[model samples]
Target chain A: TQLLEQSPQFLSIQEGENLTVYCNSSSVFSSLQWYRQEPGEGPVLLVTVVTGGEVKKLKRLTFQFGDARKDSSLHITAAQPGDTGLYLCAGGPHKTGANSKLTFGKGITLSVRP
Target chain B: EAGVAQSPRYKIIEKRQSVAFWCNPISGHATLYWYQQILGQGPKLLIQFQNNGVVDDSQLPKDRFSAERLKGVDSTLKIQPAKLEDSAVYLCASNRLRDARSEYFGPGTRLTVL
Candidate 1:
C-alpha cells in the first residue's frame, strides 16, 4: 500500500518565525495537495501541485512538489497564531479506475504562539 | 456557493451501540467522499460516490460500517456495534466531476465510542 510520511510531527514556534514541514513517500503520485485543519473542523485545502518540481504560493504559505513526485513540502513564512493548525499532505494515485485513490500523511501539528 | 454540510457535530455512545452520520454535499457536485480521521492522523477515505453510484469503498469495514448515497446529493453512514477504536472525526467532502484534484470538505462529525 502507498503511504505518505510526514516529518516533525509536532512543532512549536513564536509568531514571525519560519517553519518547514516535509512529506515523503516511496511511491510516486500524479498530484499532491496540502491542507490545514483547525480544531472542530474538517481539513481545508491549501494548495495542489500537479507537476514535478512545481511550487504554489497562497499568501504566507508556500507548497512544493518534489522533482520525483514522491515527496512534497510546505513552508510558512512569518507564521502567525492564526496559522497554527494540523497540516496534512495527500497524494493522488497516477492510475485511474477503482484503485485510484488518495493517500494522506499522518500530518504535522504546528503551534505558533503570539 | 454552499460548502458541504454535516449533521450532529458531536455524538457519544457506548461500545456496541449503533450510530449514523449524515452529509449533504455542495449543489451540482457529482463526486462525494466519506473519510474517517482518528486523532493525530489525517483523514482516511472510507467511501467514494459518483452520482449515487459507489466508486470505491475498499477501505470501509463492510461488517459493521455501511454508507449510502441514495439521490446522488446527500449521504448517510452507519456503524453498527461500534468498537472503541471507531471513535474519530467523520469528514464529508465533494468535488466536481471534471476537477477531482480539488475537494471541498465539511466540518466533520466527531464520534466517541466509549
Candidate 2:
C-alpha cells in the first residue's frame, strides 16, 4: 500500500537540455522530498533528502537519496525555460502516518522548451 | 514567512452541491496538511494535523469528507454530497511540529465536480 513510483511520465526538453527524474519504492523511507509545481502553484519545496547516500544541491538542482532508503533522484542541470514545472517525489512520515506521513510520486512533467 | 494559505481560487460544483475549503498556516506551523490534487496526480494526503488534533485521516473520504483544525492554526475542508470524482485540487500544508519534517504549500482549491 506504500507505493511511490515515478518515471518519465512526461518530459519535453529542448533548451540547454539535461534531465533525470525517478523515485521508486518498495517501502522504507525516513525522509525524502522534492517538489516543484507551477501552473497555479502549490508545491514548491525543492529538496529534502535525509541520509542514505545523501547528496543535495540546489543551484543546478541535483538530489539523490537511496542507499536503501528506497529510491529517489532528480537532476536538472542547465535546463531552461524557467525549468518548466511539475516534478515531485515524496516518501514518508510513515511507519504509520504522522511521523511525517507523505507518499506521493506520480509526477514528472517538465517541459523546458526555449 | 507567510506561505500556506488557501481559499476559493476556483470552484464549479454541481454534482451534489455542498462545498467548503479554506486553510491558513505558516504562522507558526504546528503541522497541518490536507491534500487531494488530481489533475496530473501527485499530492494526496487527505488529512493530517498535529496541533488541533487528528494526526492523520487515513485518506479522508470519511463518507463524504470533512476536516477541521480547531485551534491548531486554521483549517477546514468539507465536501459532503459532491462526487464526480469530486473534481479536485485542494491543498494546504504546513510543518514545524518540531520540525518533524518540512512542508509548506497552498494556493490550491480548484474543484470542478459537474
| Model 1, residue pairs in steric clash | none
Write candidate 1's Cα lDDT for A3-98 as tens digits: 999999999999999999999999989899999999999899999899999999999988999999999999999999999999999988777643
* Chain B TM, cand. 1: 0.97
In candidate 2, clashing pairs total 2
Name the weakest run of 10 consecutive residues (lDDT summed) in model 2 chain A. A92-101
DockQ-derived CAPRI band for the predicted complex in model 1: medium
Q: What lDDT is obtained when candidate 1 is compared to the true structure?
A: 0.92
Cα displacement (Å) at residue B57, model 2: 4.6
Name the candidate that leads on lDDT: 1
Name the TM-score of candidate 2: 0.34
C-alpha displacement of A16 in model 1, angstroms? 0.9
The interface RMSD value for candidate 1 stands at 2.2
Residues A72-112, candidate 2, lDDT per residue (tens digit)?
A: 88988889999898888888754644367778887989998
- Supply the global lDDT for candidate 2: 0.86
Worst ten-residue run, lDDT, model 2 chain B? B95-104
